[model samples]
Target: MYVAVKGGEKAIDAAHAWLAERRRGAKEVPELSIAQIREQMTLAVNRVMAEGSLFDPDLAALAIKQARGDLIEAVFLIRAYRTTLPRFGYTLLVETAKMDCIRRISATFKDAPGGQVLGPTFDYTHRLLDFKLAAEGSLPDAPKAEPHIGPVPHITEFLNKEDLIQQEPANDKEPRDLTREPLDLPADRALRLQSLTRGDEGFVLGMAYSTQRGYGRNHAFVGELRIGTCAVEMEIPELGFAIEIGEVELTECETVNQFTGSKTEPPQFTRGYGLVFGQTERKAISMALVDRALRWKELGEENVGAPAQDEEFVLYHADNIQATGFLEHIKLPHYVDFQSELELVRKMRAEAMGTMQEAAE
Candidate 1:
């Protein structure tokens, strides 16, 4: 039996049709290709991949198109798709030291080991509007030398050799997966870093900015920032040896921050680490700063009630989906809620007026 269309159902159907028409735009205008988005909108795809924890460029591109260029929605779509896939054995720890680097630079040192490869950055370019680009113009490629191959040593290793920086102890413990398990309070460093990696970029950026603006100000120097491809390998149960699964582009950031020694400890520079899915230096750097701020308690420093230093605050508010869902839910019908509120206000006013009349009497 066919039922009559309700107000909401009819409205939803019309809205969907309108949205589809809007997504297409004018008939004369050429449609945006998935290839174009995959190539040109690389950053958006990267964010989706990073946040979704799925590294398929084609799928990300498709999601971006379906979402009408909303990267967060694309990320959510990818994440939903990812949840359906069967889990296999975990991969081996990537050897980042052997990364095929495209870009690597350090703010601390004049010249780094592999030398600074500017590689595909907008760092030196001026923010100018070019009318020619509006008509589909392109610029010539910048000059760059072939980067030094093999394992390029980290700059902090030099400082560590001289006891100038705090030593990061090697941990043999397996990291906890946030996706598989529920997030608990006072999370360990590994769990915290995982949350930050997939957290909303804007939220993390704001938290980091708050720290720099004196909310939890810890003087941070970029120890090193690198963008590169690293091989991901998985040990096959059938095979005796591990086989290379694939390569992924990654952005890694390490921040060296000022450390004040406790009564029993000696002074040494401390560090914060950030690793993300692609060419996202700003997010990576911000994550490191926020990570450092959150570690104040472990370092024996006073928790000055800063927003970044509060683990509960950062972890709870960082997920865009959680934030967006709650935000958008305000649009839902609230007739009952409003009616109750109106009744309460009217009753209060009546009581106040009665009291005033009694006083006058």
Candidate 2:
């Protein structure tokens, strides 16, 4: 066992005091407000919320500021704060079909039913940094339009009508909440999705990239990717009906994978789905690819022994908070453990040298 040496309660308190002072750098500069972080650093806030499994933008922003712009640390703070919250009734499943989309597109079809609406995106922008922004220069106002009046049906629906893609039968089973219970192996699709949606973006992205590099070989085509705000509804017992409580920005991706057929089944394309918080297209796309790779068994495909295909491996390591905690623990006091190892190594060395001397004699 490792034991603490010189560090004491006073030292810890002093360290924390220094940390708070360092978090707010320089008296001349204006301090970053929670509102500023929420408004300006929206993407970072969204990531923190998504990974933290909490949808409070304000809380995420505060965590970000308190953590001094460390997104993972912000996520950790948010997660810890989330545990203190009282459990309320669960919300109904969000209907993506009725999403008030700001950005929508389909790579597979040129003329998708909803038509491509390129809402605020960095896809077409040049990589060059704008020097004008260094001084916080203002710019012209972007044009706006009236909100669309109808539902934007999924692109997969059109393909499903032609029986070109596999159909997903509706399952109304209540998904298990991983937070409430300890994670068990052989997790269902719902549990897997829950873990993945809150998983580390970099880890998921890398795992997805591996599949593209012939690790799992799931050829994925972005059938549809849409970003918008969807209403969150919860059933009120007093009211006796579900009512919209709030709206949340979401990024949903549906990837059409390679066709699979067998002696017992007809040829049809498979699907991989991703639904994440905020305008995280890259993360959503990566999520879809990895989701497909993990579905090898369900899709009747042979196990490729890829890391992405291993559900246990992916789920276990995907949580950044857990991974970071385990990794960071190594930095803690290991003095006793180290001394024991040192003594053992020295004894072994002395014995080997004594034996060599006797042989020489």
Candidate 3:
């Protein structure tokens, strides 16, 4: 797909300079600082971090600023930068149960163990724009409450206690890495989860929506959704133990799917899980639905040929970087390629015309 751009060193340089100037916009206005983007435009930063498969907020914010607020372009920059960094050993498995949750809610039960905490949510806010924000004014500090003392229990635990939910077997084996190796078909749940976690938000959301709209209907209930920071631990081989390296903000969703019963086993509700970096609640919820849809085979349910159920279709097109690269390349210099296509069309038309003329004669 590489097209040779004959020669335009000066022109290219000028274009780069122009782009930089345009990105700065109106010299009078203050240029947005990286910290502002990191703190203020946090949601945008989170999306970039999720898609870029990188967890660095400052770097994600820098990418967002450099890309002129184009999130996809920012993700592309972050991904490109990610390749140049040295690889470190993988961290230990994160335990969501022990996460210091800032926000926790359950759609299934009105009263849950840890109690529903609607922390810093836009759920109750009206969509109307406030003109007051346009003016420079300070707002009153938000009310604060004491943090919860013990580990927040999962909602699925209630269903599990009565054997109402299917129990997934624990496996200690290391899962395959999609980044390290070529993606093969019939991907395990681990690999699929890895791809979905970093997949395009919109694409995943659409696929998940399709399933709910009867494409592959599996009634889903949000057993619990939690948003908070979890400590990331990395094992030190020298010390022979793991140590807390850092903490990362995360959103996790657990869905209780419809029950399946057979002659051999009793009816039990199934589960779908989604975990992503940052407070991307929507993405996390969508991911859980899609994950459940993709589990038809394992769940002993028939695949209804749904888009979400098609592993190849979902995984192949999930990556925005790959999709954008191929799509945007069409706008690039395709002189040689277009000329060949033009010649072929002309030849076909000429042959058809010649045949028609001979028949008329």
If scored against the real structure, what TM-score would every candidate get? 0.93, 0.96, 0.96
Q: Rate the local accuracy (lDDT) of all candidates.
A: 0.87, 0.89, 0.90
- Which digits, one per residue and each the tens of the lDDT, describe model 2 over residues 1-361? 3444766999899999999999999989998899999998989998998899899899999999999999999999998998899998799989989999988989999999868888877899998999877887787677765445458999999998999998886888988998777678898888888888999999999999999999995899999999998999999999999999999999999999986686545788888988889888888999999988998877778887999999999999999999999999999988888888888988999999999999999
- For candidate 1, write residues 236-355 as lDDT tens digits: 988889999899999999898988787645788888888999898889999999999998877888889999999999998988877877998888776667777888898999999999
Report RMSD (Å) for each prediction in the order shown: 3.4, 1.9, 2.3
> Candidate 1: minimum summed lDDT over ten consecutive residues — where?
1-10
Name the 10 consecutive residues with the lowest summed lDDT in model 3: 141-150
Off by over 4 Å in 3: 1-5, 145-150, 262-265
Clashing pairs in 3: none
Model 1: lDDT equals 0.87
Once fitted onto the true fold, the runs of candidate 2 whose alpha carbons sit more than 4 angstroms away are: 1-4, 144-149
Q: Against the hidden true structure, what lDDT does model 2 obtain?
A: 0.89
lDDT by residue (tens digit), candidate 3, 213-252: 9999578999999998888999999999999999899999
